[model samples]
Every structure is written in C-alpha cells, then in structure tokens.
Target: MPKAFPDRASTGWHSHRRAQLLFSLTGAMAVDTTDRRWLIPPRRALWVPPGLPHSVTMRGRVDMRTLYVEPGSGVDLPSSCVALEITPLAQELIIRATEAPLLYEEHSIDGLVMRLLLAEVARLPTLPLWLPLPRRAALAQLCEALLTAPDIGAAAAPLAQSLGISERSFARWFISETGLTFGQWKQRACVLAALDRLSAGAAVARVALDLGYDSPSAFTAMFRKTLGISPRELGRAKPRTPIVAHG
Candidate 1:
C-alpha cells in the first residue's frame, strides 16, 4: 500500500510510521538526508527507513509510486536510505500500484511486491552524486555561501581566499574531498536545488533561468541526460494516496 501525491513536494524533514519505497515511473526525483542524498530516476527508487527524517524533490511531470510497508513486512530491509535500481518488474509494480485505486488494501500481491522491492533495493548502484556538504562549522558556513549563489564566477575563489588558500589550491582540495571536480560539484548542486524548486510546483523556465541555464531547453536537456526524463513528465504525474496496513 502507498500514499501518492502527484506533482508534489515531499514534506520537509519528516518521517513516517512505516518504511517507504519511493520511485518515479516517468521522471527523476531526489532524496536527501541530513548528511547524504541521491537522485532517483527511472527504474530507480529510494527506500526510506521508518522514522528517518528526510525529504524528496521531484524533477518534472514524474510518474511516482511509493509503497508504505507495514512494520513487520520489511524487517530485513536496510535501516538507512537506499537508492535501488528498479528492474522492469519493479517499475511495472510501482506503476500498477499507483493506479490500483485509492482504497486498496494490503493483499497477497502487496507482499509479493514488497519482497521483490526489498531484493532490488539491495542492488542499486552507488552514485557519486551524494557529496557531503561540509559539516565543520566554519567550512560548512563557507560552503553554504557558495550554495546560495553558485552561478557567480567568483563564488569558490572568495571562499578559498577566506580560507587563506589560492583558488587553484582550493579547487584541488574540493576535488580531493568530494571526488568531483569543482565544476562538476557545482553542477550537481545546481541540479539538486533545481529539483527542489521544480517539485514545489515552480515553473521550468523560472527554475532554469534561476539556475543560470542558457534557456529552458538547455536545462531540460541537462536534466533528462542526468536523470533519464524531462521536467514536464516529473511535475505532472498522479498523486499517491494513503496505503492501509494489514496485520
């Protein structure tokens, strides 16, 4: 069973009574914890552990399905958020579950679906996109400044200056720490931020312009390449209704 909210932004920093399997059938989405995050696209889902504070951001008109498993049903599941590679079977299950009517109950099929989901959840590839956003007080503050205005050409340079290092040296340090070039890291950051805005019912053109993209088409191309779907598809999908739990 599941709760669906189409073209919707996830509740901020909250958790649920049951574990949730979050996937998009049509577009891409993002899931974030305090220290970790990932992008979930077609045939990919994020298993959110029960009572774990997190949030999801959809990219475009996304076809999404979230299965809310009861307490005992997922006892063997991982305790942390997992990015699962959705198999064709898993994808079909999500899509079917989403359209299975608002008042559906936990049935034999739900158990079968949950079991398969747990198996696939263990198989998702670890993407490099989930970089740490510096947690040290001073460094985190510096990073926050860069996050707020990523398009400014001198964004990183100023932080490096404040840290008493040359821009080149700072760039190298960022790469060393994040396993991503400075430019790549900034692009990921922009994409993640754009996901949040787009999920919250913001317009594609507005988000693209705000992210400093040349145009909406350019942004859509980037988004599609990154997550395997367009923004329009992510934002306009059907809603998730509350799933009932069975004993």
Candidate 2:
C-alpha cells in the first residue's frame, strides 16, 4: 500500500497479523518498539515481524509504501524488527508490487515480480540504524534520555555517576547487557540521531555541532565508518519515486 503522511504524523502503537516491510520513497520515519528504536531514512525499510507492537512517526512528509506478507507465507524473515538497506532493484520491485493487483495470477508477470521482490527482501542487508535499550530500568531510562537528546561527547564517568555505580563496574555491566562497550553504544546513538537530522535536510556541519561533535569532518568520519556513506552523499541521494508498473 502507498500512503502519504504529513510531517510529524504518527501511526500510534499498532501491530499487524502479517509481517510488514515499511519503506518511504521520500522523507524519513522513526519506528519504536518496546526495546528498540529504528530510524528509517530514504532508501531504507523496516521489517516488522508479525504481532510486534510498534509505532511509526514521520520525520517529514513521507511517501510511505508498505508490503504485507501473510504469517505462513513460508518466506524466511527476521524474527525481530530491523532496518534494511533497499537496493535500487528492490526499490523498483517494491513500487511495482504495491501497484500490482492484489490477487494476481500465480504464473503471471505480477506473480514473478512478487516472487523477485520477496527474494530481494529476504536478502537485503540490515542497517545499523537502531538502538537497543538495556533491560535494567535505571539503565534503560538513561539510554532513553540520551536518545531523546543525543550528545556525542557524553561520557561514561558522568553517566555511571548518575547511575550511582563506579565507572569500571558500569563499563563491565554495560557490555554484558547491551553487547556493546559504552563508547560503542554512544556512537551508535549519535549515528542514529545524525541520520534523523540529516534526512530532515539539516546541514551536516550544523547537525555535527548540534550533536556535540568538534567538527563536521570528525562527525563525517564516524558516520562513514558506521554507515559506509558520507552525510553529504546521503543527502544528495534523495529518493525518487519509481515509475508505476503496468500490467
């Protein structure tokens, strides 16, 4: 299905009986579940497994496209929510599938498109555009605060002090709980925040400074290392609507 959401519009907590691949041809969205939050920028999609309660908030005017797969479709999909990098081929196929008849013949062209699209979805590379929340209540609250107002310069000493734990103990517990070192987790949080801002047309330097980076170059280096693409390149690669497929 193809739908347009005005800037800041939200689809309050909901779940589907079938799995869904949520993509946007333009703008960006944030998908929040119980334990993680995913930022879906242009050219990326979020795979929501069946029965996973989630909410999507538009970062801008989003031209959203969604594909629903029945629960027993026999396709191998992730059990949890993930952000997938959509290749050009998959982008075109998704657009076509959204336009195809709902009940196209099994051996027809629409069927072939659907089959190819499913294959692409099953193999699409997952992006590191999500932040996993810690299970502990106090730690989770701290993480949530950082996500709400991410600061690249946030330090473990201050965070640990706020949690009433020694820095060394906090470091050990953090890695054991989240599977990432404190610095690593902080960087991921900053990257997700930068993506959200960049997709909304924020200038790279402005976003860098706003996120507490010393310089745009410093921020770009981290962004490229984590996401494999520079901020400017991503901004320039704005998504375009694919031509509708004719039966």
Candidate 3:
C-alpha cells in the first residue's frame, strides 16, 4: 500500500540490505547525503544505493511509494543517491509492487512484475542539482545561512568576509570540503530552492521571484539548461512506452 508521511524526518543512516527507490506521489521531500542533498518533487524519485548513509526530510504532505529492491536487482543504478524522472510506466510498477504481496508463489504475476520493474529502473534520468555543503565550521555556518534564506544572493566576497577569511582562502576551504566550486554550489542551492517552491504549487514567476531570479523567463531558461526539461513537465508526464508484458 502507498504510505503518506507527514512532517517526518529519517534516521539519516544507511541500510544494510536494501536499495531504496523513494517516489513522491504528492507534496515534496528532500534527501541528503553527507556530501550532497536532493530535492524531490512529485513524479520524481530518489534511488538510494544500499549501505550509503542518507537522510529524508519532508517539506510538506508527502505521499511516497518506497521500493526496497534486493541488493543485486538494481545493478544499473548509481552508487550514490540521485533524483530521477518518473515515467508513467515506472510509476505504475512502483504502485503495483507496493500493493502486491511480499512473497510470490512460483510463476506468479508479482514475480513478473518485479522483473520488469527492475529492467525499467535503469532508464530513469538522474538530475544534477546536488547541494554540497562544506564541513568546515565557518563554511558550514555559511551554508546554513544560505539554506535558511535560499533567496539570498550574496556573492562569495561578502560570504568570505563574514567567515573572516580571504576570498581565496575561503574558496580553497570550500573546494576541499565540498568538492564543488563556490559558484556551482550556489547555483545548485538556487535550483533546489526553486524545485521545492515549484513542487509546492508555486507559480514559475513567483518561484523566480523567491529565488532572486531577475525574471521568470531567465529562471525557466536556466532550469531547462540544468534539467533538460521544463519544470511544468516534471510530475505530469505521460507514458512514452507501453507495458507490453504482464504475468
């Protein structure tokens, strides 16, 4: 059955045996690893590699379908957590799998469903909006401030000053800690905040304003460049391929 988690936070640890596919059917959620975080909206799922430490945070009412695949079932998936685009067929498989019994008899429909589902798992598109927070005390504080006010558009110089370090020193510290450039991490933060707001049903124009975009068109253009699709197409996708086989 589908589970709806409202205002919940994960233990933020790794699991031993299961690779999880967490899809949001309603509302929005964010998943964070020690190094990176992803914001997941409806029609999107996050594939978490087994034994990788991570945490899930709910932004609002979250309806999620979580699939715990056997260790080797999702071999084509990445070793790290990634936000994926959910096709209609994949969406149906997850919902059906969740509704089916855990154990299947030999030659059962459930077994076939599981097999087909595994094949489709490799086709999901992993987006690149990873929020990498630096671990240094001062830099981490800087990240926290930006996250707390996602619309804040302060440049690196000001941030460096606030951290009481030369801009070059702060840049080196950020690179050492997060493996992302100052500009790259900032862009990701803005996109993630935009995703969160849009998933909550905010209009694109309004989301642009909230994220400090000069205009909605500019924000949409950037989003398309980063994700290769419009934000409006995220959760409302139709099936590109039909399910041809079922047991």
Candidate 4:
C-alpha cells in the first residue's frame, strides 16, 4: 500500500523477514543500519536485505512505496544494503507492483512481471549515497557529533586532542576504522549532512554557510559532483525561505 509520512517520522528500528525495495515517490528519507546510513532522495531507492535490522526516518512528507520479496525468491540482489538508481521502467514497475494483488498467480503474466521487477531493480546502478560508519564506539561518537556540527570540519589536531590522542594516532585510528583519511571523511560528512538539510527544504545558501562553504555556488558544485544533480533539481524540492540580513 502507498503511504505518506510526515516530516521526521521514524520507523524506530524494525526489520522484515523478506527483502525490501523502498522507494520514495516524493520527498526523501534516511535508512540507518549498523554499518552505514543511506540518504534516499526521490531520485534514488534503497535495497534492504532480509533480516537486516534497520530504521527509517522521513525528511519531508514522503510518499513511500515498498515491496517485500520473499526470501529465496531467486533474485540475486545485493546481500547488503545498497543505494540504487531507479530507472524509469523500474519506477513504473514499483508503482504497479504496489497495486497488484497481495498474492499473484504463480508463473502467470502477473508473476512474470513481479519477477522482472526484481531483475530490473538488480540491474540498476548503485550510488554513493551511503555513509560508512565507524566501527569503534569512540569514532562512532565523533562521527555523530560531526553530522550535527560539520562546521567544525577537518581540524584533526583538535579532534585528536578531544579524544585524548595525538594527531598521528588519530590519523591511524581513523584510517584503520573507516579506511578513509580525515580529509575524505570530512568531505563525505559535509555532503551527507548537507543532503539531510537540503532534502528537508532548508535554503541552499543557508545550508552552505552552515557547513562552512565560502559560497552557495561552491556548495552546489560539491553536491553536483558527488550526487550528479544540482541542489535545485532534487525532485519535489522546496527551498526554505532565506534568512534576512537585517541588522
């Protein structure tokens, strides 16, 4: 069934025995798992493997369509959570699937269509819309802090100090934990955090400034480079009103 969730509504840690294809026909949402977090804008979808514990949160009034595929259905989907590029055919099939009878006749046209749906979804390209989380609790804590306070940006010395470690030690730990250098992690964090705010209708300029960009255009460049879409073109986007410059 189609569903609508208000902004910031949460599923609060749930899982299904069957794998799921979660698509937002409008607005955006986030899917969080132990290993990573996915920002699923209307332009993308998330494939969640069966039995993988996850939580969902809405970024706006999300028009959500989901499908539950029985395990052992012979669809060789990714064994882990993945962000996917939803092609036009896949989009149509997803919408159609939601409207089909809960139980379709096996091996008939209806059944064949549902099977093709899985094939099409598996063929779609994967996107870098996921944020790899650190495994260590200390590093994880710091990552959470960065998400809310990305303006604090890549100052490794102070971060290391806060963790009671030397800069060199901090670098080693970061690399060991996430396989990303401090600079790489910072940029990813900035982009992810920006996506969260942007999808929620926050003004692009304000989000840019909040994330320490010198200009909104610069932030736009980074966003386009990383996600291949300008901040303005994200589907159903409604910019939050710009804050006034009144003295």
Candidate 5:
C-alpha cells in the first residue's frame, strides 16, 4: 500500500493480522511499540511482526509504502521488530508491488515480483536505529524523557542518582536488561534522535547544538561513527541501480 501522510500525522496504536514492512520514500517516521521505538528515515524500513501492537508518527510529509504478508506465507521473516536497510533493488521492488493489483495470478509477473520482494526483505541487514526501553517504571519514564529531548551529555552518575540507586548497581542492571552500557544506550538514543532531525532537513549545526553536542563537528563525528555516513552525505546519497526481476 502506498499512502501519503501530512507532517505529524499519526496512526493510533494498532496491530495487523499480517506482518508489515513499513517504508518511507520521503521524510521520516517513528514507530513505537510497547518496549521499543524505531526511527526510520529514507532508504530504511521497519519490519513489524504480525500481532505486535504498534503506532507510527510521521516526522514530516511522508510518502509511505507498506507491504503486508500473511502468516505462514513461506517467507522466513524476522520474529521480532527490526529496522532494515533497504537496498535499491528492494526499494524498486516495493514500489512495483504497490502498483500491481492486490490479487494476481500465482505464476504471473506480479507474483514473481512479490516473491523477489520477500526474499530481498528477508535478507536485508538490520540497522541499529531503535532504542530499547527499560521495563522498570522509573527507568522507562526517564528513557521517555530522553527520547523527547535527547541529551548527548547525559551521564550514568546523574541518572543513577535520579533513580535512587548506586551508580554501580544501575550500571550493572542497565547492561543486564538492555545489553548495552548506560553510556552506549545514551549515545544510541542521541543518534536515533539526530537521524529524525536530520531527515526532516534540520541543519547539522542546529541539530548538534539542540542535542547538546559541543559543536557540529563533534556531532558529525558521532553520527558518522554510528551510521558510517556523515549528516550531509546522507542527503546526497545516491540510489544504487535497481535489479531486474523477471517472471
């Protein structure tokens, strides 16, 4: 399905009987589930497992494309939510599928396209664009606040103090629950927030300062290290040649 959403438009919490591949051709979106939030920008997609309750909010005017696959459809899909990096071939396949009739002959060109799309999606590499939420109420609340207003300078000591726990205990618990140190988690949060802002055409300097980075260079360094691409280069990224899918 191909649809357009105006800036800030949201789909209230919902779930589908079929698994979903949510891709945006333009703009960005945030997908929120009970225990995680994914920031999906252009050239990336979110794989939502069937029956997982979730919601999506557009960061700007988004040209959204989605594919719904029935359960036990013979495709080895991911068992959990993931953010996948969309290759050019997968991108083209998705667009083509969206244009085809919803019901098509089993051996027809449309069917072939659908099959290839599923294969491509299944093999697509996942990206680290999601933030894991702690199950503990207080920690979850703190994470929610950070997502709303990320601070790159956030330190474990202060956070531990706020949670009324010793720094060592907080650190150990955080690693046990999230599989990431407090510093690592905080940096990931800031990077995801930066992607949302950068995708919306926010200037690098502005985003850097807003995220509490000392300077744009420092922010760009972190962004590049996390994603392997600088902020400016993301906008200039060129699409790879599409692979031809034959019947």
Candidate 6:
C-alpha cells in the first residue's frame, strides 16, 4: 500500500502474518522491532519477517510504499528484521509494485513486475542501520541505563559486578547477544540516541556535547562514517518521492 504520513506519525506496535517490505519513497522512517531499531532513510528499505512485532515512525512528511508478501512466496528474505539497501532497479520496481492493485491478476504484467521486485529485494545488500539490544534482562537493563545517562562513564567491570557475573561472561554475552562489544555497543547506542534527537530537530553541537563527543566535528565525522551524510543535511534534504508508473 502507498500512504503519506505526517512527520513523526507512527503505526504504534503491530504485527501481521505476511512478511512486509516497507520502502520509504520520501523522507525517513524509524522501524522498531523487538530487539533492534533501524533508522531507514530513503536510500534503504526495511524487511519485516512474518508475525514479528514492529512499529514505524516517520521522521518527516513521509511517502511510504509498503508491500506485503504472502507467507510463502518463494522469497528468501531474512527471517529477522533488516535494512536493505535499495538498488536503482529495485527502486523502480518497488514503485511499480506499490501502485499495482493488491489483488492484481497473477498472470498479467503486474504479476511479473511484483515477482521481479521480490527477486531484486531478496538479493539486495543490507545496510548497517539496525541497533540490537541484549536479550538478557539484566544486560538489557544496563544498556538502557547507559543509553539514558550516557555521561555515566561506567565501565564494564562495575556493570558486570552489579549483575553478579564475571567481566569475561558479561563481555561474551554482550558480544553474542548484540553483535557488539561493550564499548562498541555503547558508542552505537550513543550515536543512535543522538540520531533520534537530531531527527527531531536538535542542533548538532548540542547533541555532540550531550552524547560526550569532545566536539561537534568529532560527532559529524562519526555521523558521516555511519550515515554517509552530515547530520545537518538530514533536515534540509527533501524526501525522494518515487515516480510510480501509472496504469
């Protein structure tokens, strides 16, 4: 389905039986899954596996194109939520797919178009937009605390002790559950939290100091490395609305 959402509008938390490919045709979106959250820009699409709880929040006035794939349509997308990089070919096909009728004839040109879109989507590369959390309650709680009071400067030793585990075990759990070491996950958490503020129109310098970055330039460098664009441009860039081919 194709829908336009006002800035910051959200779908709240919901799930469905069919897998979904949510492509942002304009503006940006934040897709929150059970343990991970993804900041999906126009350059990316988010794949949600069947029955996975998710919520979508628009970053600006957003034109969202969503395709619900049948539970078993032969597409081998990731069972977990992922941010897929949108190739130019896949981008065009997505627009076509979004505009096509939901129950269009399977043997017609629309059918072929949708099949090709799925094929392209399946093979598309992924973006590193997902921020995963620990599944363990204690570690998850620590991560939440760290994200909230980022200035705590608490080391893993203290956190591990508080959790009644050895530092070695805590490190292993952190890496295994979140796919990031304690320090790496902390940095990622700070960056992602900064992104939430930045998208909501916070100034760059203020976010930088708040997140413990020594200077705005340091934060900008990290943002550039992660997002491939300066955070300042996030507000100024117009959402890219795909030109759907009309029947």
Using TM-score, give the best candidate's number: 5
Q: Candidate 5 versus the native: TM-score?
A: 0.93
lDDT of 4 by residue, 19-52 (tens): 9989987778888997888788875789999899
User: RMSD for each model, in Å, please?
Assistant: 7.2, 2.9, 2.8, 8.2, 2.4, 4.1
Which of candidates 2 and 6 reaches a greater lDDT?
Answer: 2
Q: lDDT tens digits, residues 6-74, model 1? A: 554565778899888877656567667886666665445778777888877656556667777666663
lDDT of 5 by residue, 93-134 (tens): 999999988889979999999999998999999889998888
Over 4 Å off in model 3, which ranges? Answer: 7-16, 235-247
Residue pairs that clash (backbone atoms under 3 angstroms), model 5? none
Which residue ranges in model 2 land beyond 4 Å of their true spot?
Answer: 238-247
What's the TM for model 4? 0.89
Rank by lDDT, descending?
Answer: 5, 2, 4, 6, 3, 1
- Residue 185, candidate 3: Cα error in Å is 0.9
By lDDT, the better pick of 2 and 3 is 2
Put the candidates in TM-score order, highest first: 5, 2, 3, 4, 6, 1
lDDT minimum window of 10 residues, candidate 5? 236-245
lDDT of each: 0.66, 0.89, 0.79, 0.83, 0.89, 0.81
lDDT of 2 at 156: 93
Prediction 3 global C-alpha lDDT: 0.79
Candidate 6: lDDT of 64? 89
Minimal lDDT window, size 10, model 2 = 236-245
